[model samples]
Target: MRTLIIIPAYNEEGSIAQVIGDIREHAPEVDIVVVNDGSKDRTEAIARDAGAEVITMPFNVGIGGGMQTGYLYAYQNGYDAAVQMDADGQHRAADLPKLLAAIPYSDLVIGSRYVEQTAYRSSATRRVGILFFSKLVSFVTRQRFTDTTSGFRAANRKVIALYANYYPSDYPEVESIVYLKRRGCRLAEVPVEMRSREAGRSSITPLKSVYYMLKVTLSVLMSASRVRVRGVKTSG
Candidate 1:
């Protein structure tokens, strides 16, 4: 498949190069593009130097906007598949092939760490959030999801076009799945190991954790109430 890896970064200069290098080393055949979300650091230059296409936003548009930009690029440039990964080195490039390989069978493939449990550990608070969102989405969509908050995912042209037009603006990972499911998209998850960030810090702090859960919960509920698209053929 002709795949484009989209890495949305915000002030991730500390680990951008290493992330790019890991992709090149593991998934050498696919192309990569880094969406610099108005980063104040050298993320753009370092990503360019590391040999990946860089799309710099005028200002901080957050992860949703940055990802929409990358999906727009992939849709316009005619990429068969697009993969979203983090620039903080938490997502593994070695799992790229597994994601892309599942593209033929599903409209969207998520790289999940909890599908089978492979040495991936998180804080108690984060785990609770993940579990809560997972159960919520599964109940809403009537489909099982082990990791609803995972950013690592691969999308076929159908999903690329959908995401290009509309994506959740904040904390998109959990809500986006419900959006696609309502539109009759096939979604699957594959087990993958994730690493702790080697640089930079998480945007969600202890204080923000409560807000994140509340906001995402509302978003998922709202997304679930939207009318389902009729006769949407997502199968390849």
Candidate 2:
């Protein structure tokens, strides 16, 4: 299948090259699309130099918008599947094939941190927060989501159409799980080892994390209650 690895980059200059090169090394035939989300740094140029097809947004559109643009490009370009990965070095490229292999059986394939180990070495509060989000998403979608915030996922044609059509304005990882569930999309997970960022600080501050959870909760509720009007115009 023709797969496109869509990396949404925003001020990720330090890791973009390594990320792209790693993907090329493991999956050289897989196409890459670097959505340079208005990086104030040299992320776009570095990604381009790394041999990825770059799409520069005039401004930072956030991860949701950037990923939707990837879906648009993938659909228009006739890609069979698409994987959404982070520009940060946290996600490993080696685990990409595991997700790809499972995409055939499901519309979405998630990289779960809680699939086997629960006590991951991170901030105590952060782990609790992740578990909270996980339960909330599971309750909403009737599907267990161990890692609701993992961006390392693979999507098929159905999911591409779904996202290209009702993605959220802000954080989309959890909301997307609900979105796909509403559309009868199958979801699966595989263990993908992740690492701590070696470069810039994380954007998930305590306040931001709280705000993100609330926003996602609201989005999930809104998604669950909304009537799926057939053939209605949607922008995800």
Candidate 3:
């Protein structure tokens, strides 16, 4: 498959080059595109220097908007599949093949940290939120998700087109799974090891994490209600 790795970056000048280099070293065959989400830093310049195609947003549109731009690029360029990875170096490039291998079985494949158990750890509050969302998503979609917030994922052309047309704007990862399920897209998860951020602090603080959980839960519930009422299955 013609796969494109989409890295959404915002003020990631510290780690963007290393992330791009790792992807190039590990997955040379696949194309790479870095969506610079209106970074005040030199993220776009560094990404360009790293030899990956760069798309600079005029303003910060958050992760979802940046990823949607990548999907649109993939769709317009006729890519058969696309994989999303972080620019902070948390996601491993070596795991790209595992995600791609699973693409033949499903429309979307998520790289999950809890699938086989590794050394991934988060705060207790965050863990509780993840557990709550996991069960809630399973209940709504009838598909269990071990890690709903994981940004490491691969998608087929159908999913690419869907996301290109419409995607959540903020805190989109968990809600996106539910959206795909509602649209009748097949989803699966594979075990992958995630490393700690090599540079920069996470944007999610304790207060933001609380808000994230509440907002995502509400968004998922609202989307599920609409799907049930419409009784419509979205097509590629």
Q: Which candidate leads the pack in TM-score? A: 1
Q: Pairs clashing in candidate 2?
A: 165-236, 166-236, 167-236
Q: Highest lDDT among the candidates is held by which one?
A: 1
Every model: Cα RMSD to truth: 1.5, 3.0, 2.0
Which digits, one per residue and each the tens of the lDDT, describe model 3 over residues 1-236? 89999999999898899998999888899999999999999999999999999999999999889999999999999999999999989999999988999999999999999999788887777788888988999899988898998999999998999899888999999888988888888999999999965333778887788788889999999777764324335332
Clashes of each: 0, 3, 0
lDDT value for model 1: 0.92
- What TM-score against the true fold does each predicted structure earn? 0.96, 0.93, 0.94
lDDT of 2 by residue, 135-168 (tens): 9889987887889888899999888887888687
lDDT winner between candidates 1 and 3: 1
Report lDDT per candidate: 0.92, 0.85, 0.90
TM-score between candidate 3 and the true structure: 0.94
CA deviation > 4 Å runs, candidate 3 = 198-200, 228-236
